[model samples]
Target: MKSARMLPVLVLAWALALGNILTVGIAVHAESPAAAGSLAAPESFGSISNPDQRSAAFFTELGKVLTHPRCTNCHPATDRPRQGDLRRLHEPPVSRGPDGFGLATMQCSSCHQETNFDPGRMPGHPLWHLAPAEMAWEGKTISQICAQIKDPKRNGGRSLADLIEHIGSDTLVGWAWAPGFGRQPAPGTQKEAGALVEAWVKTGAACP
Candidate 1:
């Protein structure tokens, strides 16, 4: 009878101990550096008020995607494109041949097709090739990319309006969001990226 009575108290003590542990865990997480919040929303850029500052800030936000592996891989400073999130060099010794396509024997179209093939772990889009040599973004600062993106001579002759359209609606850019075979997608949706580009242009297209 005494043992049975002690069982209730023991069970109650364990429950209290578990509750305390959970409470401490939550408090620790709340205080931890790893618990920082996510990226600021696009609307938050409006808080800058200064058009130049806000515009530059907008591009900084869009920079999240522009610098991501999906975009940067093809925009390598060297002739070879990188692969995967690690930004490793292209395997099988590919190079950016004339017209940004591979050599006749090993064209990008030889592997990357119209869409991603999950079975092959190959990411594909109809336009899967290197950006022009002038448009190389690898090893450049976001500010540099920002400036180059706005320059007609460096940006493949695109006007600011053309840039807005390209970033805002280009299907090739959209492919960054749906990279297949278990790769990490870019920071946000392509539409969200486009909205940032549009906002950046509308405000002043300032470089960070």
Candidate 2:
């Protein structure tokens, strides 16, 4: 009788031990950082021999970077530019004056200094100014922007070749990826984004 009672207790202890081992295994799997947040990583701009398909993929993925807060903030639809990740109305109610400069007395150069000044809460750039009306991306879908970009009338008369240099080496585009202090940088580094642009141009700059 004592042996029978001890057998039941032993089986229960074995089951508990198995459960603990399984729980620990699951925890180890969960805590591995590499396995977590895999979805948030940037997509690989893998090479493509097919000019058409490669061109399309490049622009499609590049769209994510271009349409981000940093690029779209200055390319707003209305005269008033938006700011921050929320894309809220520009503070202090500034407007894109006749020449894409600023309202009469409150020139963009007045507050947006040559360099970012965290003390003054100003985000700056060497040539800080609004994008031309043709480059406005606010209220535009990726498809629309892609189509417009391919049109000479809308793209500042630049050929596909021009886009490689325009996006890859342009100071303003580079600024989006490096805007300083408390500002969230754009999705990818400037060089990586520029390489993607170059690759897209080489593949013929297909619209997506």
Candidate 3:
């Protein structure tokens, strides 16, 4: 009689445990990172026989990363930088100030430290500031941005060769790949992006 009574309790306990497992599984899936996409290798475009066409194609591949929210958020057309994957304007209404950093009373480093704070969902780097106004990429076409990048006046005075180092190895640029919590990283690895830049330069840096 006691075992008969315990049978119902045991079955209820099993059902509760199963429900908990299912809930956890669903929660984990929901919180997982979204597909951030990928970039084609530079060699993959070798099939294009024309150098100009090949260079343009290479840059077009690199454009996948350049045009992503990760790159565009900091390169806002307006003085106010954006945040989040949705590319929303930053809260608290901070401006780019005379420098790329925020106004005197509200510097970016004040909230963003040297590393990401997952608890607060804030991303950081040692040099956390917006790109210069002239270099803003937001709302620009790939070809327009391409033209701007090749211009010393608009590209922070970087030469085509300088861009390779900046994109491939700069820690600040690398941060896009490792942006903390709730963010989709830019497409592909930095090295791949760098290789595309190199290939594009070698092929005459043609724009799409």
Candidate 4:
């Protein structure tokens, strides 16, 4: 009789567990792409009336990728770039030399080969090197980075069109999406980021 009495309790427990599992599954499916680490289309910010505000909104979304470690590790505020998701000081001690490559003793290509080596856990690309010192973005506000990106001298003479091409289709920039096994990729794909740049320039390239 006691065993019979406990049977209902056991059934109730399993029913509750099944209900919770279904709820979680439904929630996951409801999540948006931007919520799942991809950029949203510029038109999604439809509530804003001003074109400049809408432009700034687009860049703000792009900022998610720009400020990410994949982009920042190479855009060090100082000469010495940092690494890892934690943005810790780079191991093996390296710095931006006169031409954005390392010194003769510690060239970037010395360890970072043409392709990432998951076995050794080193991220690489054929053209990996620091951005110019003037483009250093670590510790700067999004507004500051935006201003620098618009200036020809700071942006390496890139016209708005050139900026779109560089960020949109450049193979080196595309690497941020495929950074090695242990690293977190930037928020969205490079193509998406470039599209945002193009939209921003078309709408006045306003800064946030």
Q: Compare the candidates by lDDT and give the number of the best one.
A: 3
Identify the runs in model 4 with alpha carbons over 4 angstroms from their true place.
Answer: 1-35
> Scored by CA lDDT, what does every candidate get?
0.86, 0.77, 0.91, 0.88
Q: Which residue runs does candidate 2 get wrong by more than 4 Å?
A: 1-50
TM-score per candidate, chains pooled: 0.80, 0.74, 0.83, 0.83
Candidate 3, 97-193: lDDT as tens digits? 8889888999999998999998889998999999999999999999998999999999899999999999889999999999999888998989999
81, model 1: CA deviation in Å? 0.4
How would you encode candidate 1's per-residue C-alpha lDDT over 87-196 as one tens digit per residue? 99999889899989888889999999999998988988998888999999997899999999999998889998898788778888778888987676777677777788
Against the true structure, candidate 2 reaches a TM-score of: 0.74
Pairs with backbone N, CA or C atoms under 3 Å apart (clashes), candidate 1: none
Model 3 CA lDDT for position 53: 91
Q: Name the lDDT value of residue 201 in candidate 4.
A: 92
Q: Quote the RMSD, in angstroms, for model 3.
A: 5.4
Candidate 2, 165-204: lDDT as tens digits: 7777888778877777766677766666677777777777
Q: How accurate is candidate 3 locally (lDDT)?
A: 0.91
lDDT tens digits, residues 1-208, model 4? 9999999999999999999999998787667332476787777878889999999999899888888898899899998988888899889999888888898889999999999999888989988899999888998889999999999899888898899999999999899899888887887788889889998999999999
Root-mean-square deviation of candidate 1:
5.7
